[model samples]
Target: MSDSTAAWVAAGVRSVIGAHTQAQDAGRTDDVVALYTPDAVLELPGMDPIEGHDALREAFKSWAPTQPQLHLVTNTVVTPGAEGEATATSDVAFLQRGESGWAVHLVGHYEDTLRRHEGGWRLHRRSTTFQ
Candidate 1:
């Protein structure tokens, strides 16, 4: 994929993440798995890595309620990879709710593996590390 194509895919992925979370809190528990490829995986610090689109959707399900109030920040770059693929690296910040207020806030870097499929660029693997 070209740089512009990679950029669009990265933007689309983030947009879907934001939109789906918003919709989930609004009472539509529609399938979130469709946003990802079949074999996608996501790894977050202190949590087990999620494999497959179904698992990813389940992971999102667990975060549904808090998503509405949480503030999600992402800064990303998508670079072309060998063999017509691309990679996306994003700096992420998330604030989780706490009794006193939001306290479990985190800053992290996300390393994502992307490949160009018939549909477009899709995430294959994603791992994040805390700052």
Candidate 2:
């Protein structure tokens, strides 16, 4: 495949992470659902893999109301096939209001399986690893 095509695919997957981080920063949970595929699944170490759009959206929405500020950092590690799917990983950091001061937290390694969609690329699955 051409370098530009590869880059574009990589960028598309990377943007899903961007969208989530941006929305989190803006306290906008409504759009979080669109960050993943309709059948997307999320696996965070201690938690079960959250499946489907409705549940995932709801989970994020729960946090959205709290208005946490977040930042995401990602790297598209590879484009394995011509199907426009890729693997990427990200780091997410945020701060939330607390009794005394803002508490800072970091979630790392969002290993993702991304697929090409009508609009672009969407996250198919995410496996989170604690740092």
Query: Number of the top candidate by TM-score?
Result: 2
In the predicted model 2, the residue pairs found to clash are none
Q: Give candidates' CA RMSD values in order.
A: 3.7, 2.4
The TM-score measured for candidate 1 stands at 0.67
Tell me the spans in candidate 1 whose CA falls farther than 4 Å from its real position.
1-31, 96-104
> Candidate 1: lDDT of 109?
80
| lDDT assessment of candidate 2 | 0.73
Clashes of 1: 0
Candidate 1 Cα deviation (angstroms), residue 80: 0.9
Clash count for candidate 2 is: 0
Residue 34, candidate 2: Cα error in Å is 1.1
Error of 2 at 38 (Å): 1.0
The weakest ten consecutive residues by lDDT in model 1 span: 20-29
- List per-prediction Cα lDDT, in the order shown: 0.65, 0.73
